[model samples]
Target: MAKSMSLLWGAGSPPCRRVMIVLEEKKLQGCKHKLLSFEKGEHKSQEVLDINPRGQFRRGVPSFKHGDLVVNESYAACFYLESQFKSQGNKLVPDSPAEQALMYQRMFEGLTLYEKLKAVIGYTWFVPEEERHDSALKRNKEALATELRLWEVLLVTFFPTVATLFRFGLSAERYPQLGGYNALLKDRPSIKASWPPHWLENLKGQDNLKDI
Candidate 1:
């Protein structure tokens, strides 16, 4: 019998989306997906706790359960999956030491920017306008823009293979290069298959990076 792999995830989560992209890329079979509801505190339930006791934000969503081995932390899970399943799908980590080092650098940089992106989203979308600190929001937006400019330079250097781990896009007028980057990879099978479901329904005018 094939081994079972259970993915506990929440929709619209970047970390969760990252794991889903890996699973899709590897084309894993006999895997089960369970969506958790934060509103209902499903993640805190005993069943989930058994699989992942940490359950903290960083180690929370995007957890992978295979037999008795449970892996949390999106990067840890992703690296383990990619290394273990190398024979199955496209090799996510490169073989050359220098290229691999560059890949890790990109991932770490993306994670740093992800925190800033989260701040932008929290301040813009989730927080009420009256409760927000406009000054802080402005600072975060500018910081995120700066990081994106760096990404544009890297994309030019790497030409399409850089930052394949994260899906970030922006409006053309605001970020022409990143916008073009989004367009370039919009149709990739992994991205297309793992595209956020809600975004698909309201695709016409939705800005993928409105918060930034």
Candidate 2:
């Protein structure tokens, strides 16, 4: 653990949760840590401002105000933690040459996942009820549907062993695979420890209906 490292984060945001998850997964031999509260307005404080030049971020990833490295994006934080704690989970990240290529591909998909989810959250919950845009909602939902199909097709085409289990294209399809994947993701102790439990409401679980 670095002597001067600190993680500024919120309790329920997925982005912050991801950071915490990565750290816990790495579990470097000795890491002293602190969790700053976003609800307390710590993120907007001068301390954070000094470290994050942009002074702004998406999701719950906090800006680092005074560190050798500052990160405001959750995915970047994941990449950073993986690099810093390579020893603990020497093989946590994909290592084989083919896996390496797949890793980048997954990261790219993960980035897209983050962006699309953010849009869903912003449209469904963040925007004030009165200011909410139907067009935006429609667009996001449509996009989500499209993305769902893409994921389903890939699952069926490339991972057929797990294909029967996931219903990706529609809520009415059999999605045991996707559900299994989500269950696996949630099973990770690191993700379980850091993931925002309170925000589960935001998930609405509507996507699960695809298998209906």
lDDT of 1 by residue, 76-96 (tens): 888888888888877788889
Which residue segments of model 1 deviate by more than 4 Å?
1-3, 54-59, 124-132, 156-169, 204-212
Cα lDDT tens digits for candidate 2, 1-212: 44556776655555665566566767742444446666676666676667665545333345422247677776687777787668775445776899888777865775565455456545655677888887887777667556655665554221211221132223323444554555555555665565454345454323422422
Score candidate 1 by TM-score against the native.
0.79
lDDT of each: 0.68, 0.54
TM-score of each: 0.79, 0.70
Model 1 residue 102 lDDT score: 89
